[model samples]
Target: MERGRDTILLEGLRILDLTYGPSGGYAGRLFAESGAHVTKVVTGDQEISTFKDSRKRMIRTTDNQLPETIAEQLAVGHWDIVLWDSHMALHLESQLASLLEKISGSCLSVRIHFPSTVDVKEEHALQEWGGWTSLTGDPHRSPLYIGGFPATSLVGAHTAAATMFAWLEQKKGFVQVDALTVVVSALEGVYTNYLETGEVRERVGNRHHTLTPMSIFPCQNGFSFIGAPVDEQWELLERWMGRAPNPNWASVDERQQSYPALEHCIADWTQGMEREELFHTGQAFRLPFGDVQTLEDVKRCPHLNMRHFWKGQHPSDGIQLPWIIYRHSSCKLENRSHSLKRLRILDLTSMWSGPYCTRLFADHGAEVIKVEAPHRPDGIRGNSGESPAPFFNELNRNKCGITLDLRQEEERAKFLKLVATSDILIDNFSPRVMENFGLTREVLWAQQPGLIIMSLSAFGQTGPYRDYVGYGPTLESMSGLASLTGYRDGIPWLPGFSISDIGAGIHGTFALLAALYFQRRFGNGLAVDLSQYEAAIQLIGDYIIEETFSPTPLQPVGCTSIAELAIQDQRPLEVKTSDGKRSISTPWIIDNPENQTYEPAPTLGQHNPLLEDYMAKREWHHQL
Candidate 1:
């Protein structure tokens, strides 16, 4: 947790943020919030309403021409980092390119040009990330864009990360974050599966196409999720409903083929139970069960309150929002605890959030062992065939693979042995799964007291919804994101991607890192109860504030994005709603940037010896 003390992180660092849209705006915000002095130089006529002023970050509307004083200041001193949004090419070309190129660290934002065979070099080019949504959403319906999780927020996160990393390296170079590519990378596995199998993953409502018993079902109260990916769990779900498991539904293929009947049966069973009660009963039995949650419910969640997850005022809005969730006493690059490369993470997550977190870790040099069960490996891995699916490969790259059935007493003990050797353990299992195997945090902590364990679930472990089953899509709806994402006077829309999953993954990573920081600085271990739904809820802080403070009522209605709303309603003095979306592509390219590619994912159980040697070395040898 970030202390509200006078001492700040990145105290004297300065950023000249000459950017726009979500990408540039967000990148600057990251630095500003981290205690850097950020000056956002924008054209006066452009909408500044979408963005608010903060303590360390401020927006200065400016003309295209550089004022003499600023030009002299630029020539005299260097900015720690210069973020140039693609929109300011002429100014960059005529005056600022040389200045930006020489900076120690710089980030360039480009709206990805999709299917580019033709050249587009016009200024203020208007284009929406339409293809992103076109390829997302339900295949049965027309293409739709999600509200709340804007493209800029996502791209800006990546850009900020890149900039920070560059600064840590103390390197003189620029990195380009393609708005299109960031979204595409998030959607990478789908494309790889398509390219390999020629099987298009049609939007199948909210149910998973490949996994068994993965869908949102309605209960007496509202919609909830019942996700049972394996046979034993499927049997548990069935037994909870007072029914016997059908032998025909033993395999994933069988269940997937019989999905319609499966869903109907689950729906019929769940429809009779109260949503909250059903969620608890299923959780008690270790079945993945989740219910739809309102924003108010999230704010009032006992687990979050107990964890002190939300507190402190946001400088942009006076209302109390979550403090910078990823806080460390210091993040100096030289500190081993702060560097991802120095830590070893044992990954028990198969699909989205946990894998995503470790992926970021591996990208920055963390040694990750992606553990799976021999009987049931990662559900995504089997989506294609004996060979791991491309989607699985893309997400789980740079990770060593091993198999362990924690359900077995011997395997559980072996897992504990490995835990002693690891710095952190990450998993996104339904809360009860780990406990059912007797691998609870207390047990693991006994074996390794300093371990930082992150239990990532759809809901936090202690919450009423802890055992609930919901993925990225369902989370979008339950978290009020879906309600806020549609066109004005239209139905709520899915962003077509699992943003919550990705967000949880990123959030999980930062939380784990923060825990590591805590361990080093304060000699304490951390049990992080990370909820995907909670992470999604946190992203809509501004709306939560509006709902809390404004005298005017704000409901989750189908409307354009808050970026659009913040512009029209709050900053109406700047951008026109009629202007719609603009082309955000940049014509510039990285001339000579350094790059590194990762090693391939290991074969499942390829590193079984690591477990065999865990007790001896208290460390696993890496495969070169």
Candidate 2:
């Protein structure tokens, strides 16, 4: 696994990409970017877009030559990974079965499938079938689909991740990733709420289900999200509005009851101010605010520009991608039967982005320590009196939870002790929080120089908006996603859930794995600054590129109609939690014999004793 300094993370890996659409194409692009030698075999006259095809070698073939071409390629050399779409499977099922048998023990093959309900390869119709369309846009209007092929893009990401997992584990198998399951998995709290309470959530325009003032408000020039979901943030908003904190608007429930009046009051205050002014002012008050940015605005975004996020040959094409800033160093890693069995992660993340990122690793046998302060546990755990939320259990499954008030010196010392033996540290706090905690890269590296630190923030760790706070909706609004979502003539609307959070999590997991691969091969430590905003923009990068090149702007269609078909009602695979509550299983379906069984999420501080033992040993020897 040794490589030269000039080699990229996945340089030695060879991938044969036989994907027909953007779903598999995006996955190949990610592999290519990480330095894998990706060869895309095009069986038709499909136009190759620079965004998805730039780093890959292209081979053309007719439909009739597909099987022969694949056999020829497979014979020439061993490919570490092979990717194809389900549509291609219809024609080459027997051919693939024979070919795969020859390479079954050596290569990881991934097939991307649309739901059976989708008779055509239409993304909009797939969205409708997956329930994404039904949950987006205004409740009074027709359901809207998210801009770009987000569902498919997510499928690609998940497919890439699954492939990497198998590769790391040195397993030979076939993996199936479907668009419908990926979409349903990302619905986040929506399905969980329905299952737990039997409450079918409908479109609430731009507002959050429980969080008040988390909606887009019109500014003098454009719209901006004034999200103050937390009580502290809401109080700041009240002070900024030159009003005393009224008792009626004290709690989330109270604010929900007074939604109309509160929204009207905020809208009135914001209507006269420009979006930029409102954004900065609200951020200065420590409120989570964001500008509803268009593609043009996103192109000129100072934070993205400063981070050099818009890369590739044509930087002006507005092709935004993830940027991983690395520092040179070295460490030794032991190979394990399970991909991440030897890996230890300290997850200091709350809500969705960071938790979801670590959860992926946890599911694959990583020792993930979900660290939270006693006073401020992960917000998704729900209020003090209630049981942990279903979304929390789903996202944090198979992870060890321990409360450590980092603010206290004793707890901070224990955490640093754990860091000395850990491989990675991930946090989604505002950029300043790490600095405030005096846990800078230099400080953490002093304990373990080869530690891979990943920070998933709203606007990243640098740039002007580095300190600004934001949630998934804020990032979505700012990432140009919201502007392209909604009816053609209607205002921009957010997706049913915090899609940006989930998207960032998936992207973060991939990026972290890439870094992990590098660490294992070269023993080098890296710092990955993942912005949920940039990650959101990347999901719709093709659309942005299209809009940049096209004469007319891309308009949102509420929902596209398709011929009626017998949509399959295949229930998603589920596993029972420790409480006997059923939850959707992890989206990947890999035919690997060594896959671990599902485990229930840990209760708060459930693994405190485990942490105590690790601290006593000053090493991670005992498995949870």
TM-score of each: 0.73, 0.92
Count: clashes, candidate 1: 12
Sequence-dependent TM-score of model 1: 0.73
Give the distance in Å from residue 501's predicted Cα in candidate 2 to where it truly belongs: 0.4
Query: For model 2, what is the alpha-carbon lDDT of residue 65?
Result: 88
**lDDT tens digits by residue: candidate 2, 1-624:** 122212287788999998777778889888887789999998666768677788899999998888889899988868988888766656586788689888888888888777655543446656776677666777776677787667767878888887887778777878787666676777766665556666666667777767898898888898998899788888888987888788999999999989989999999999989999988988888888989998879877888777777664345454645755666445454442235777889999988888888988887788898888888788888865137888888888778888998877898899899998888999998888888888998889889878889989888887888899898889889988888886666467787788888899998888887777766776666788777888888777876676544321232343321111112355454556556775666677764424456566777787788888877776554445
Alpha-carbon error at 307 in model 1, in Å?
Answer: 4.4
Best by lDDT: 2
Superposed on all Cα atoms, the candidates' RMSDs to the truth, in angstroms, are: 9.1, 3.6
Model 2 lDDT at residue 158: 83
Local accuracy of candidate 1 as per-residue lDDT tens digits, 352-394: 7678778767656678988899987887675433466566766
Clash numbers, per candidate: 12, 0
